[model samples]
Target: MSKIYVLDTNVLLQDPYSIFSFEDNEVVIPAVVLEEVDSKKRYMDEIGRNARHVSRLIDGLRASGKLHEKIPLDNGGTIRIELNHRSFHELQDIFVEKTNDNRILAVAKNLHLEEETKEKGKRVILVSKDALVRVKADAIGLEAEDFLNDRVVEMDSLYTGFLEVYIPLDMLSRFYEKGELFLSDISKLPFYPNQFLIMKDVMGSSASAIGIVDKTKVKVKKMTFNQEHVWGIHPRNVQQTMAIELLLRKDIPLVTLIGKAGTGKTLLALAAGLMQTEDFHEYKKLLVARPIVPVGKDLGFLPGEKQEKLRPWMQPIFDNLEYLFNTKKPGELDAILAGMGSIEVEALTYIRGRSLPKQFIIIDEAQNLTKHEVKTIITRVGEDSKIVLMGDPEQIDHPYLDAYNNGLTYVVEKFKNEVVSGHVKLMKGERSGLARLAADLL
Candidate 1:
């Protein structure tokens, strides 16, 4: 018995081809959904762009037949636009306001009632990413589900990509002597690709060791980089670990880092990039750039060149660079940057129509981007170019995004399964002890 899945507008906006994701099930799009999609199609951001895509997809479907009449999709789902299911009386009690959501809920209720009458015994569920909508749907005795298809993983099951397990002193000695130990040697050890392990002596005799496992192939002694301690930052936290993994790993080509504020995601990436690009010379240049978003308020325009216009957003990166370079005067770092010119910090608006090759690219504050925007950034990568996208998913300041549906979350979730990608949830704040306490408490 195929179930009927009524999609909310957000699901389609988040994913233009969400109709095909159901796979052989009956997909219902309330007439209100089309109206919402039409309203959003004219905007320029990801939502608006996705709205246009959904419009094109629906138009392509119409070439086969009318959407109100069942149209078979390529992925074995039948899509139907339901314009006739609206009734004000069904939802007038709780949702007195005639919002689009209320109208869609009315359609879902009617569809559920019809299934009950027909004795099909099939499940009818309303899927939405909005918490209030889900609550309202369940309040009316209709089944409701959050649009969790875009989540990276369940709350507790999010990929950590590494783990530290305690072992007995004797076991640690045996492991050091043998050079390798089977996973079964430890009863409860969770690990992922390129994960590091710290073996502390159980009885504490200043005997400890650290090693990294290369996806279960070989375990090698963990070589400490001077840069790790140069900045006085610890990589034990998950975000730092993720940043180090992306910056240090030579095999993986794509890496994305996401977390809230004070996670040290950007600092870690910059430090690691400097190590790989300048110290190691792994790439031709260490290109650092981020979209020139304003801080607090946009100061209209500046009187000088493009560099002047970008000073506000790029200043944070420069501040980090100044700290790394240990510059005495404020303008000294600028002179150094002018001399190298290799590290470019132009706005993302200009990167279009350009191909970057043999460079380590870092895009910061990426949560403000849309899926299309992120795709545009990724597609610009040339041969041998490695791009690292780091941003705080929870601190998204984008107008149309929430915690779960932001472009950053979408990228992290969608790309987690690929061999070239990895992700981790950085729960601790490493900027400062006070910052960490504020991040945790506030």
Candidate 2:
């Protein structure tokens, strides 16, 4: 029997194409969801864009058949807008509020009761992205679940960009002597381009070496930039070394770095960008941008000009830059930035339609971005531009995204096979001892 999936407003807002995800099942959208989506359609953000997209999609579907009735979808499923069974009497005792969420729950509850009476094995599940909504649904004796179609990988098994492989002690010496090792001669497991390998001694010795899979994918080569310092910053750990290798490689246009707080993700990315832009003159400029997602309570309506208003949000970027520049005086870094005119720090909001060519773009805090938002940013890269997306997936601030489905993880999984992209997940925190302890324990 086909199940019934009643979607909440947040599900559609998170993904406009969620209606087509249920295969051969009935997708029912409460009328209140439309009202909720409509109220957010005018905002200039990702949610508004998704809300408008959902509205357009539902309107297009209506051309095929009446939405109030069963409208057949292309995936052998049916979608309908529930206009009836939204009476609050059924949920008045349980939920006294007549809010939109309550109305949606009432629709789902009525459908579930009706299905229970008529069909034998049919289930009505409320699909939402909100945790509180799921809890309320369970409180009212309804089956509720999160929308799991957007997740690219399980959080526990997320890609770390490197693997530990044991090899014979002789092979480790041979790799050192020859400066490269054929992957076929080592492990039989499949490896992606630019993935790091820690070749340990099979005899349980302390002898080990690090190598990265080359773009050819046939062999693992030594890291070219492992010994080089970028903007006076050196790699503190093996993961940072691998990240530096990818960051300095001009061939790899897309690089992603994932780690916890104080893992030097932003610091390393800024160092490489500065070195490539100011020292090597590889690119025309260094463009640093990040999504403006506030942590905890937001300080609404910052009072200042554009740059001043952006300072609070971009202070972290400036802190790393100051450390790299060793600026001791007030406004010294600002003077340098103004004198060079080659570095641009802006929010990801203004980067939508601009064509960035011959530039090194670093998008910090990328874990707060959605898949579509990241795609839009990547597609804006012009010729000779290398874009690096780095963030701690565990520290996401976006309401609808999680570690498994954020833009950073999504890009890491999707481009792991492509030769033009590389990824590294830094494990150790190098900011300070206390910071590391907090990251691990707290």
Top TM-score: which candidate number? 2
In order, candidate lDDTs are: 0.75, 0.93
- At residue 375, candidate 1 shows an lDDT of 82
TM-score of each: 0.80, 0.98
Report the C-alpha lDDT of model 2 over 1-442, residue by residue, as the tens digit. 7899999999999999999999999999999999999999998999999999999999999788999999999999999999998878889998888988888999999988888797485899999999999999999999999999989997598878999999999999999999999999998999999999999999999999999998888999888884558888988889999999899999999999999999999999999999899989999999999999999999899998999999999999999999999999999999999999999999998998899999999999999999999999999999999999998888989889999989989999999999999999999999999999999998
- What lDDT would candidate 1 get against the real structure? 0.75
Candidate 1 residue runs with Cα over 4 Å from true position: 74-77, 92-96, 112-124, 139-141, 174-191, 202-206, 215-220, 224-260, 275-282, 291-309, 327-332, 367-376, 398-427
TM-score of 2: 0.98
Where does the lowest 10-residue lDDT sum fall in candidate 1?
Answer: 217-226
What's model 2's overall lDDT? 0.93
